[model samples]
Target chain A: MLNHIWLALIVIGILTAAGRDIHEVSQNSYGNGIPWMLQIESPQTISVYGEAVETSLRVPRRQLQLHFHETAAADAVIPARVNLTHAREGVAVLDVTGDVPQQFKIMAEALGSGETLTARLRHRGSGWEAEFDPVSLVYLKKVTNAAFDIAGVAVQIAIGLIGIMALWLGVMKVAEKAGLITSLARIVRPITVRLFPDVPADHPAVGSMIMNISANMLGLGNAATPFGLKAMEELDELNTKKGVATDSMVTFLALNTSCITLIPATAIAVRAAAGSSDPAIIIGTSFLASLTATIFAVTISKLLARVKMFRWDRSEAE
Target chain B: MEIFRTFVSLLSAIAIPALILFFLVYAAFRRVKVYEVAVEGAKEGFDIAVRIIPYLVLMLVSIAIFRASGAMDVFIAIVRPLTDLVGIPAEVLPMAIMRPLSGSGSLGIMTETMQAYGTDSFIGVLVSTLFGSTETTFYVLAVYFGAVGIRNTRHALPTGLLADFIAFLAAVFFVGVLL
Candidate 1:
């Protein structure tokens, strides 16, 4: 089943390696031409509050188009340099008069000095109206060391061959026996039990967690897709409320997302391939971040889950 | 003192592994005792590592291809509309963009994102940090489900996908509103 996918991956690998010159495969993908959407996110709705608030729409020179009058000024859309002064602390609106998109949306948020907001305008009958908040464009401040990027890319390519090499070289049987696969299963199992104690092993969450970890251990994050989803559904069963997400489910998601990625053999090896001075700089960060996020996310989710709305809902008819 | 200690610790972690290899090789030569156990252990590790090497290699190669082909641009573009609908900022698309790719690819992207923006930039840090913490859901699911011989992942896919989605949103929310 994954043969097809793996095959495609192989072709992609060959082509990517071959075409590395043509592709601007950055260690990071965000380019300056596009404006970075700077904003805050809230589950509940955010009201605009005051009328005609002065919000600065920051667009990356790539995405932002400039114009002197009504005539088209630049060949490319980009974050145009603008001259403006701010008043006080509250939301301030700035006059944006230039070549804008016919109909588009810019995701936005408040920023200091250069308050950022996304600007979305529908090319209506008359003129453009704001579809979404004004968005600002921010460029990449940190560039992964080009050499580091090369190393990172190289590691990725090497991993692509790990399975093939393993099968060809012949340690797969030992792997099967050693329960190396259980490392992942062990990590995900108790989490499954904690989340769905009542659910059976064959149930979606328990089974998927097992399967998901198995795939993950095999270095197949893609393969783990179905299992993760099944796990979620089994978890969702505990959420009896509607329109609101449950705390346990949310926490479960956080813990999983913030999963402490123990033993980054894959990454360290990648760094080794790329020829990094410190292949393990990632070891600490990965460990620290994953653990912190797991704890923080789980705690928050658990706290919020204590609210009554997160409980399992029963049918009115029943 | 603390900073110096951290640097020392970090150096030891890096060098210790290499030092062990040297010691093992030395031990293998002296009494040949270390070699006996190590050879057995390594034989096992090497075989297992090699067996999984193909899987690792396949994933790495494909990600390389995705990077090389500019498919990432198209892929990111295709998903851009979906993200906008969901309220994820377009700038932060790199994290979402790299989500489907290998960890290194995403991490590199995350690193750049942090540099482009400030580390204090909520989304920037959240995303970069999140990329490190989170596993690629579909990738993990496919390999594991396939390995176990449980083809009918009908229930499993939804559960994991939901987990991924929720995680994505939570990261965005935590960064967006709280941070």
Candidate 2:
């Protein structure tokens, strides 16, 4: 299932990018090779040759409609700096800032110019004609860049976990050695017995699972991860079929993903940052929602385990 | 409600240090060599992290492609009608769909939604509640299963996704009740 889903994402992403690029080409989306007529509104007279002079470039709505073929295009006044080496030939850099069209911004970025777009300018009688580098296959370029960037970021995320993982795992090791984990498991036997019928009640896995779920409930994600991973390692020790997830693992994962919330800290923090009068307003709602999902998650995990395809006996590593 | 909020916040803040202190002190009292044993256990952390590199890279790269290609717009278009039938506001549909796939993507959507609609608005509350309630299913699956080298994750993905779906519905239902 994971193999298929993973393949489908890549296939769909590539196809969609190709389709969009083809559509853009057919529609002349970026007005490739088309020259734009713009009005220069600054620098009363061209005095400093080969020196950049701050200027304002006015793009008329009619010209916008002609170039991009969008009837709804509005007149845009862009702040720019121009370097004119001759009366007829010059270079203008348009600051791609507030209120600019989305297409134009993308074009600027695709052209490798971060926040400014450079265009070749020619003095045409009363106005200037500006020609921008053609942009094509933008979606494909974006998809390629994203894939490469995230691959490295994935390693960074894993490396970043080393310190935290070590800290929590070390603490958990001490707890286990001191016999604290065994007692913790004993305290939670009634619940663990039902949730994980396969694992023994006094097993250390139950202790780690309990700790994980508690950390998750309190929104301690960093702590939750190490404990959760520890639980997986312990549970794996009981697996008869190596390289396959047992029913207990599935149930634990289901519970973890939809664990009940005591405080939705990240949500409240974002709300507060966004200037909400009552940032913690979602606490009750989040708790209720997560509780409902967690109940269903556990039930679903148990039910699905009995199905023929997903039954533990039928699973084998490919 | 205020008291509960304060209590949980304080608990989460103190949880790590307190747990570390308690475990170390208890182990010391029990005559366990704390530093040596902890270092031995910490050694496994590096191996587990390094072992999961392949899984994490492939999983995150796929998700990044889907997001960058703007396939989500098409995906939302296809699912919009089904969601509409269930009384889900079209505005928060992106949040529901993105929540399971990518954490940062959904965070961006949540922030953007709140900025567009006031933070106190119904849509704003619903999106945040949705974000708060569910984990990033794919990420969790990758990291957790990846650590153990579990190749055949039987029933885990489907269960997690279904759980996330239920969480979205519950959020919508509860947020509706709240407003």
Name the best candidate (by lDDT): 2
Expressed as tens digits, the lDDT of each residue in A44-139 for candidate 2 is 756879888888789988877876777844788888888888666899888987677677788887888558899999988799899999999999
RMSD of each: 19.5, 1.3
For candidate 2, write residues B1-179 as lDDT tens digits.
99998899999889888888889998999999999889888888888888889999999999999999999999989999988897789999889888999999999999999999989999999999999999999999999999999999989999999999999989989999999
RMSD of 2: 1.3
TM-score of chain A, every prediction, order shown: 0.34, 0.96
Model 2: residue A222 alpha-carbon error in angstroms: 1.3
| Shift of residue A94 alpha carbon in model 1, Å | 43
Task: Evaluate model 2: give its lDDT.
Answer: 0.91
lDDT for B171 (candidate 2) = 92
Highest TM-score scorer: 2
What is the docking quality class of candidate 2?
high
Screening candidate 2 with a backbone cut-off below 3 angstroms (N, C-alpha, C), the clashing residue pairs are: none
Worst 10-residue lDDT window for candidate 1 chain A reads A138-147
lDDT of 1 by residue, B1-179 (tens): 34633564565355434534554554445444543444343343233323333344344545554554554665577888888897787877767656645565676776566557645556554655456446764444333332222232222323433444555665665555544
Model 2 residue B32 CA deviation (Å) reads 0.8
Candidate 1, residue B23: lDDT: 45
